[model samples]
Structure formats: structure tokens, C-alpha cells
Target: MANLNPYLSFRTEARQAMEFYQGVLGGDLEITVFSEFPDMVQNPDQSDLVMHAQLTTPDGLVLMASDTPDGMPFEPPQGFSVSLSGNSTQRTQEVWDALADGAAITMPLDTAPWGGTFGMLVDRFGVPWMLQGDSE
Candidate 1:
């Protein structure tokens, strides 16, 4: 089966952002630094930058990210959000609260028109997320 995962790019915050996500999402995180790959080492100043980071949550969610090498243009994510839906309402609310730390809430998590809890927020790492609680 094929899988589609969100790939995020950060200027130099990939390591921090991915680590934060691991804490919030409770996952196994594997990271590789730019210095680890000699061929990919473009700037010594950014040698510690995360060349690749992947977090796989126990719920089967996978997120991947990398830092933009120095001398390359970096733009924060916009226009799209990483949407999360959970089977358990309690777990869903737990995640929402965790992500709400230092987040800019675009919408308060509350009863939606469709009767499910829904909300939007941009986390401190500048990543946007939409959370939906149990549909039923």
C-alpha cells in the first residue's frame, strides 16, 4: 500500500520543531544532520542542521522534515494545514491541548456546525494544524 505523509521544511528549526512534535505526538524520531552526509554538506556553518527528520507516531502518523541549507531561500509554511483526526475523543482533545501550547488559536476547539469538535491553530514552530475530534 502507498502512503502519503506531510513533508515540512524549516530554515534551521527542523531539529527543534521535530523534537517538539515527538514530545507532543509520542513517537519514535530519527534525525540525520547535514554533517553526516559529506556529499550533502553545503555550508559548514549549518553543519548541525537537520538534513532529515522523521517522526512516526504510535497511531501510524508519519511526519518528515528537513532544514533548508544555508544560501537557500526559506519560506514558512502557509495556505495549508496538517489536519488531524482521531478515533478517541479523549485522545483527540489531549493532542489539541498539547499543540495549543504557545500556539495562535485561529479557532477555539468547540462544537462545530457538524457537531464535532473542531479548531485551527498555528503552533509555535509556525506550522498550522486543524484538529477534529471524533466524528461520531
Candidate 2:
């Protein structure tokens, strides 16, 4: 079966952001810095920057992120969110609440017209997210 995972790009703070997420979501996080991949590093200063990071929550959520190389343009667009949808409403609410602790919610979690619960928020790292609970 195929899987859907969200990959994020950070200017230079991917490590800190991924660590913060690990705290909130309770996950196993693996991070690799540019120095770990010597072949990918052209600038010595960027060797300490995060080249890639992956977080796998106990609940089976996998999130990946990376820092853009120095001098590279990595602009995240506004008005878009990485969405999470599943069959457990209660579990979905738990994640929603945890994510909203230090973030701004654009839409309160509530029943959607399509017969599920939905909400949208921007996490503390400025990454927007959407949560949805599937219908029975």
C-alpha cells in the first residue's frame, strides 16, 4: 500500500523545529546534518545545518523536514496547510489540541458539512496544518 507523508522545508531551523515537534507529538526523530553527507555540502558553514529530519509518532504519523541550503530560495506559501485525516475522532482531537497549545487556530474543530470533524491551525513554527476525522 502507498503512504502519504508531509515534507516541510525550513530556511535554517529545521532541527529546532523538528525537536519541538518531537516534544509535542511524542515521536522518534532522526536528523541528519549536512556534515553527515559530505558530498552534499559545498559550503563549510552549512555543514552544521540540518539536511534532513524525520519524525515518526507512536500513533503512526510520519513527518519529514529539511533545511534549504544556504543561498537557496525556500519560501513556504501561505494559505496552505498539511492536512491529517483519520477515522478516530477522539484521537484526531487529541492531536489538534496538542498542536494548538502554542499556535493560532484559523478554524475551530467542529463538525463539517461533509460529515466529519475538521479544523485548521498554524503551528508554532509557522507551519499550517489541517486535521480531519473520518466519518463512521
Candidate 3:
């Protein structure tokens, strides 16, 4: 069996970002720093950087992330949003509100023309998100 999950790239905030997601999504997060794999971290300064972080939610949502290794170019997040949609309005709202904390709301959560509540925001970690709730 196999599943496709979103893998994110951060300059150095993978730990904080993963923790934030865990709080919002209710998940178990496992993090590994570059130092854990000595061979991969050539620079001592980068040893403390996140090599890998995984957050697995009870609903089976998996979010993975890591920091850019030494000498790798960092690219700012753009052009995409991690979207969440479901029939549970209450649960969707709760998740939206959680992600809204200190996040820049590009579109306030509201009833969409296509029906249902929809919203867009860029989290503090610079990750974009879209949330949707059931129409009715």
C-alpha cells in the first residue's frame, strides 16, 4: 500500500512549522535533524537544521517537511495552497481558526459561490492553505 502526501521545504523552520501543523491538525510529529545523519550535513552549523519532519494525523493526513541543506538554494513558497475540504463544517471551522492564528488571511472564511465555506491564507511559516466545508 502507498499514499501520496505533501512534502514541504523550509529554509530552517521545519520544526516550528511541523509543530504548528500538529497543533492545528492533531497529529503525532516525528522530527529528525541533520546531525542525526552525519554524512549529509557537511557544515557544522547546518547540523541542527531539520533533515526531516513528519506529522501524521489521526485522519491519516501526512505532512512532511525538511530544511534546505547547506549550499542548497532556498525558494520562497508560491503558486500553491494545501487545501482541506470535508463535510464536517464544525471540524473544518476549528481547523481553519487554528490555522488562522497569526496567519495572513488572503480570503476570509465565508460561504462560497459554489456552496460551502471557503478560505485562503498563508500561514506564519509561509505555507498557503485553503479550507472548505460542506455546502448546505
Candidate 4:
């Protein structure tokens, strides 16, 4: 059996981003820092950085993330959006509102020509997102 989910990479914001997601999505989050594992422990200055973090939402959605260790290349997210959709317009709208805080809304959520509500934005963490909901 196999499960597919989004795994995010951050220059150093993995903890903050993951915490924000938990606040927006109602989830249980588990986090481990580089300091927790001796072998994986980086220099003392970088030891507190997030090594891994996972958020499991009440709806069973899973999101994972980690910070790029010091000296590694870092790149901002681009080329794709984390697309979210659902049958319940109200519920989807709730999520949209949460994610919209501190977000740059590229397209306001509204009726789509294809017969649904759709919007796009780049969230505060620099992650792009596309949201959709059924027209109720």
C-alpha cells in the first residue's frame, strides 16, 4: 500500500509554517528538532532547527515539512500550487478564510466559469495554493 502527500521544504520556517497549518486546519502535529538526534545534530547554532514535522488533520489529511540544514541550498516554492477542494462549500470557504489571513490573494474566491468557486493565493509562508468548492 502507498500513500501520497505533500512534503514541504523551508529555508528555516518549517516550524512556524507547520504551526500555522495546524491552527488553520485543526490537526495534531508532531515535530522533531535537529537537537533531538545526536547523529543528526548539526552545529550547536543550528541544532534547534526543525528536522521534521508532520501535521495530521481531523479530516485525515497529512502534511509534512522540514527545514533545510545550514549550508544547503534553499529555494522558494514555485511552479505549483497546493490545490484544495471539497463538496462542502461552507467548509471550504472556512479554510479559504483562514488561509487568506496574511496571504496575497491573486484571485478572489468566486464563481468559476467551470461552475464552482475558485481562488488562488501565495500564502504567508511563500507557498502557493489553489482553493475550490462546489457552488452551493
Candidate 5:
């Protein structure tokens, strides 16, 4: 089966962002630094930059991220969101609250007209998210 997962790009904050996500999503995170790779470090300063990071949630959600190489252009994400949807009201609300910390809320979490709880926000790392709970 094919699956679609979000791959986030960061300048030098991939490690922080992945850790934050793990805390919010209850996941195990694996990260590799550029220094870990053979001859991949371009600059001494960038040695500790994340080359790759993956967060796998208990529910099978996988989020990947990496820090852009020094010569590559870095653009923050826009025009899209990492949508989280499920039937667990408690878990949904917990995620929403966790992501709300240091986030800019675009839509407050509340009962939506569709008969469920819904909300939107951009996390501290500039990743947008939409969280929706089951119909009530």
C-alpha cells in the first residue's frame, strides 16, 4: 500500500521540530546528523545540523524532516497543512492542546458546524496543522 507523509524542510531546526512533534504525538523519533554521514559535512558549523529525522507515532503516523544543505535554498512551508483526524476525542483534544503551545492559531478548536471539533494552527516551527475529531 502507498502512503503519503509530510516531509518538512528546515534550516537548522529539524532536530528541535522533530522532538517537539514526538512530544505532541506520542512517537519514537530517529534522527541523523550531517556529521554522522561520511564526508557530508560541508561546514564545521553545520556538522550538527540534522540530515534526516523521522517521527513514527503509535498510530502509524510518520513525519519526516531534514535541514537544508548550506548551498540549498530554504523556504518555509505554505499553502498546505498536516491534517490530523481521528475518532478519539480525548487524544484529539490532547494533540490540539499540545500543538497550541507557541503556535499561532488560525482557527480556535471548537465544535464545528459539521458536528465535530476542529481547529487550525501553525506550530512553532512554521508547520501548519489542522486537527479534527470525530462527529459528536
Candidate 6:
């Protein structure tokens, strides 16, 4: 089966952001630093930066993230939000609330005209997200 996961890119705080997510969502996070990969540590300054991090939540949410390499640019663009939708209204609401922490709500989570509960927000990390739940 094809799985949909959100892969995040950070300037230099991938580890911190992933840890924050693990805290909010109750997940186990595995982070590998640039120092772990000899080939990537050619630049000694980047050794402590996060090369990659994966968070696997108890509910099976898989989120991957990485920091931009030493010479790369990380520009956060507008106009794209990771959309999460399902039938579990209560659970979805809980997730929406959690993600809304320190975020600006573009749309309040309410019954949508399309017959579902929907909302949009930009998380603290500047990642946009959309949460949806089936109408009960």
C-alpha cells in the first residue's frame, strides 16, 4: 500500500522541531546527526546538525524531516498545507488542537459546507496543515 507521509525541511533546527513534535504527539523519534555519516561530516561544522529524523507515533503517524545541508538554502514557501482527513472526528479534533498550538488558524475547525469538519492552520514550525473529519 502507498503511504502518505509529510517530509519537513528545516534550516538548522530539524532535531529540535522533531523533538517538539514527539512531545506534542506522543511518538518515538529517531534522529541521526551529520556526524553519524562520515561522508556528510566532511565539513566539521555540520557534524552536530541533524541529517535526518523520523517520528513514528503510537497511532502510526509517520513524519520525516531533515535539516538543509551546510551549503543549501531552506526557504519556506506559501500556499501548501498538509491535509489530514478521516472518519474519527474526536481523534481528528484532538490532533487539530494539538497542532494549533502557537499557530495561526486560517480557518476554525467547524462544520464545513461540504459536510465535514475542516480547519487550516500554520503550525509553529511554519508548516501549514489542514485537518478534516467526517460529519457525524
Which model scores highest in lDDT? Answer: 5
What tens digits encode model 4's per-residue C-alpha lDDT throughout 1-136?
Answer: 6898888999889999999999988889999999999788657788888999999998888999999987788888888888888747787788889999999999998888987789898999999989889878
Q: Which is the winner by TM-score between candidate 2 and candidate 6?
A: 6
Candidate 2 structure quality by residue, lDDT tens digits, 1-136: 8998888899888998899888777889999999988999989988989888999999898999999986788886476688888848887788888889888989999999997899999988889989999876
Compared with the true structure, what per-residue lDDT tens digits does model 6 show for residues 1-136? 9998888898887988898788767889999998888887757877888888999988798999998876776788476777778747787788888888899998999988898789998888888888889877
**Residue 67 displacement in candidate 5 (angstroms):** 0.8
RMSD (CA, angstroms), candidate 1: 1.2
TM-score of each model, in listed order: 0.95, 0.82, 0.94, 0.94, 0.94, 0.85
lDDT of 5 by residue, 44-100 (tens): 788999999999998899999999978889888999999999857677899999999
In candidate 6, list every pair of residues with a backbone clash.
none
Please identify which of the two predictions, 1 or 3, would achieve the higher TM-score against the true structure. 1
Model 6 Cα displacement at 119 (Å)?
Answer: 0.4
**lDDT tens digits, residue span 5-101, model 1:** 9999999899999999999899899999999988888878889999899999998999999999978898889989999886466777888888999
Residue range with the least summed lDDT across 10 consecutive positions in model 3: 83-92
Candidate 1 has a TM-score of 0.95
Clashing pairs in 5: none
| C-alpha lDDT of all candidate models, in order | 0.90, 0.87, 0.90, 0.89, 0.91, 0.84
Model 3, TM vs. native: 0.94
Model 3 Cα lDDT, one tens digit per residue, 1-136: 9888889999989998999999999879999998988899888988999999999999888999999976999998998889888747778889989999999999999988998899999999999999999975
List of clashing residue pairs for candidate 2: none
Predicted structure 2, TM vs. truth: 0.82
Query: Which regions of candidate 1 deviate over 4 angstroms?
Result: none
